[model samples]
Target: MIIGIVKEIKSSEYRVAATPGAVTELVRNGHEVIVEHDAGTGSGFTDEMYEAAGAIVADEAERVWTSVDMIYKVKEIFPEEFKYLREGLIIFTYIHSNAHLDQTKALMESKCISIAYEDISDDKGQWPLLSPMSELAGKGGFLAALHFSQTINGGTGKLLANVCGVETPVITIIGCGNAGLGACELAAAFGNRVNVLDINHDAMMDAKKRLPQNVTFMFSNRENLVECMKTSDVIINCVLWPKTRKDHLIYREDLKLMKKGAMIIDVACDEGGAIETCRSTTHTDPIYFVDGVMHYCVDNIPSAFAQTASATLSNATLPFALAIANKGVKQALKDDKHLRRGLTTFDGKLTLLETAKKLNLPYTSADEIVSTF
Candidate 1:
């Protein structure tokens, strides 16, 4: 099979779909890897690196897009690249279809086999492709919030960590998942008064036992959340429900309840922001004010540290790419149920129930889709 590694064109997207080492692995396994020129530059990788790894560098995206049976990418195809889609050309990437109606419509209309990385679940019920980036975003979210918490940045001027005579800022987290856990880790590391709230009793219990005494764990509810928000210097929003629009837990009026000049980090911006005031921002201009509260919601936080993010993301996805390349999607998915869950769309039909319901499209049962394979 011929694989195409296309350059990512999303705004501020810096990670590449495949690194040179990844290309070498595919080449050694009797697969032909065609990478677009300068595809890996954002990750500090060059064309020479790919050439040395036995990959053919194509000057044109058209050449890469049309010639390959499947096109692998870091981010989903942006509007500029949408014209390259052809029927049966498989797209494997982080397609946050629930949030972007236009992209979802394009994928469905194109009749391509669209495999979303976020929908693919492991036996432990975790997202494989989306995890690395989420970890990066979670850590970045804290820094973004910290920036906004400074007086010059329109914040209340409360330091996350206290001095000898000063009080520490309170960091309130709304979820206990990967992003939430990451925020908690950073906030606690910075010596802030951290409060992690989650609806999952098990997660909250685990957090209570694992974290330091300064890090508080609480059950998530309207009363608790409202009180926490009222006093919080920084609030990190990580709540998410995969394959559906995010529930805006913080309403427009909720920002008023928060302390003036408080900062918010909505890590779920790509899914949908957790805060009503949260709108997607870029690294170049990443903060805004709403009702005296500062919001930092950059959808692609990993882009800020491309080199580290690229390697980590590529390493996590390499095994799955190899599996599908060597065994083909049908056989590989049949053998591994985790890979099977990755199939968002196949054979001109939407196969994921949540995605179909969110998109208002007809649903194809997972069992039925797997049976076809």
Candidate 2:
């Protein structure tokens, strides 16, 4: 099959869909790869490197889109590229349709076989593909939040880590999942006084047992959450609802209770987010203030370091990509139940029930869809 890798056009989105090592493997598997010019430059992989691996470089996205049987991407499609979409091409990427209604509509209208990496599961019912990125975003949340907490940036003017005899920063991580745990780990490493909250008592207990010395675990309830937010210096929103719209844990009104200049970095912003104040921002202009509270909601947080992001992401996706390419999506799903769970939208139908219910759209059972495939 002819596969295409397009350069990301989103703000500061430097991660390419394919790398030279990935291209080399595709060639060995007898697949041709067409890369948009300089797609890997930001990722520190030059065109020559891809050529050495037997991939062709196309000058424009239009050429790659028209020629490839499947398109591999790191992010969702933009409105400008919506016109290039064809009826039957396969799109393998983080469709993120739940957070993006317009893109969801476009993909359905295009009638393409689209799969979202975020929705894919492993045998253990974990999102392996989304994990690596989650790790990156989890760690990044602390760094971004710290910067956002400075008074110059409209933050609460508190340092994440304090010197001896000084009060340590009060940091609250509003989730105990991968992203939340990730932030907690980093925040603790920096010597911040951190509190980790989760709805699951077992999870909270587990976190308390395993968390670093600087971290604390607490049960998440409206009262506990409100009090934590009011006193915390930095808040990391790292909660997710998977393929559905995220339930709001923090309303805009809640911002009034936060200390002046308190920072809130919603790491799960791409998945719609736990905080009501969160909206997608870009790396170029990543922070904004709402009622004297700072928010960092960059959708593609991993894009800031393209090379590492590409290598880590490609590792998780390559096997799945090859599976779909070799066995085809239909046969592949039959052979691997885990991959079958990854089916979000297939040939214009919303096979993921949660997405359909959330959007109030027509739906099909994934099991039924896989059978037809």
Candidate 3:
């Protein structure tokens, strides 16, 4: 099977879907890899590296997209690439179909087999493909707060770290998942007082065992949330909001409860999902003031650390990609229920129930579709 790796074209997106090492693995597995020219440049892998790994270097993205049996990518398909969608083409990527209605429509209309990396789960019920990037996003989110908190960056001018002969800064993190733990690790290491809130007692206890003394675990209730807003210098939200939920955890009106010059770093970045005021931003313009409180909600925080992000993400996703390539999409889906869970569209039908319900489209179960084959 031919696997295509295309350069990410999203704004400020520097991470490539595959690295030279990943291409080498594909080549070793007896699969042909077509990498677009400079596809790995942003991630510090040159075309010569890909060639050294036995991948064919295509001068144009069109060539790679057209020639490959499957397109392996990092971001969702943009409108410009919508024209490339065709029958039986397999798109294996982070296809957030629920978030992008038009992209879902295009994938269904084109009769492509679209698998979402974010929706794929392991036996432990964790999103294996999404976890690596989520951790990076969490750490990067805190770093963004540290940078934007400086007065020079139009922030409150208060340093995020603890200082001698001064009160320690407070960092509040919502959720105790991979992203939250990543943010908490960094925030606590900086000697700042960190508060992690979640409704899951088990998760909080686990986080407590791993975190330092300065970190506090609290139940994620309205009272605790309000208290955190008022006291925290930086609030990092790591919760993944459901697509069907219309209500927000932090409402726009609640911004007034925050301290003046305080900032929110939304690692989740679900527009109108978790935080009412959060709209996806780019690295070029990552922050804005809402009710005098700063908001840093860059949708792709991990992209800023392209090299590390690419390496971790590639390692986590390569095994699954190889499975599909080796066994073909149908057999792979039939064999692995976890992989089938990620199927968004198959043969022009919507296989992901969440996306169908959110978009008011027809729904087809993965079992039903796979059984037919």
Candidate 4:
């Protein structure tokens, strides 16, 4: 199998899908790895590193995109790359199909096979590919709050950390998942009063065991959330909103309930999904004001920490990529039920139920699609 590693073209996206070591692994497994020039530069891996790892370095992205059986990338396919879509090409990346209707259409019309990293599940029903990035995003979201809280950055002028003579800042984190726990860990370390809310009692209890005394676990509900909104200096949303759900966890009007100059860091930057005010900001313009409340909802927060993010993300997705490369996409998906969950599109059909329901498109089960092929 010929695999291509293309540089991420998304705005402010710095992480690469594969690292030099990952390329070496592929090369050792008898798979040809092609990397576009400077593909790993943003992640601190030079072109020479890839070349030394036995990867063919292509001068042009088109060459990499056109020559490969599978294109490995960090982000979803953007408009500029849409023209490169071809039948039988495997797009292995974080295809947020439900969020990008145009991209979904492009993939279906092109009849390419796309496996979404974010949708793939593990044996324990955890998103293995998405977890590493989610953890980074969680920490990055908290770091963003700390920076945005300074008065110089159009913030409320409240310090996130505890001061000698001042009161500790209160941070409210929604959900106790990987992202939320990551946020809570950092926020509590800063000596802030951290409140983690989740609907699952087991999850909350599990988090309570690891967190510090300053962190409190609360049951997520309208009343508790509203109370937290009124008192918390920062609110971090880590809930993975369902794509087909029409309702939002935090409504536009709910922003008014927050204190003036308070901010929201949405780790799960689902546009109109979790927070009504969130509309996927970029690293260039990461913050916006809505009803006196500031919002930081960069969809690719892990990109800010390129080197660490690239290595961790590469490690998480490499095993699955190896499986597909070794056994072929069909046999790999057939053998690993968890990997089949990542199948967003196969042979021009939308195999992801959430995306189909969200976009009003016809749905085909991945199992059914693979059986027919």
Error of 2 at 34 (Å): 1.2
Angstrom error of the Cα, residue 199, model 3: value is: 0.7
Residue 279 miss distance in model 2 (angstroms): 1.8
My TM-score estimates for the predictions, one after another, are: 0.93, 0.94, 0.99, 0.99
lDDT of 2 by residue, 313-370 (tens): 9999999888877777678778887777767677788877777777888988778976
The C-alpha local distance difference test score for the whole of candidate 2 amounts to 0.83
Task: Evaluate residue 189 in candidate 4 and report its C-alpha lDDT on the 0 to 100 scale.
Answer: 96
Better of 1 and 4 by TM-score: 4
lDDT of 4 by residue, 1-373 (tens): 9999999999999999999999999999999999999999999999999999999999999999999999999999999999999999999999999889999999999999999999999888789988888889999999999999998998878999989999889999998898998899999999999999999999999888898999989999999999999999999999998887779889998888888788999999888887988888999999998888899999999999999999999999999999999999989989988989999988789999988988899999999987875
Residues 1-373, candidate 3: write the lDDT tens digits. 9999999899999999888999999999999999999999998999999999999999999999999999999999999999999999999999999989999999999999999999999999999999999999999999999999998988878988889999899999998899999999999999999999999999999989999999999999999999999998999999988888999889999999998888999999999888999988999999998889899999999999999999999999999999999899999999999999999998899998988998899999999999998
RMSD each, Å: 2.0, 2.0, 0.7, 0.8
C-alpha local distance difference test of each model: 0.82, 0.83, 0.94, 0.93
In angstroms, what RMSD does candidate 2 have relative to the true structure? 2.0
Candidate 1's error at 92, in angstroms? 0.7
What TM-score does candidate 3 reach? 0.99
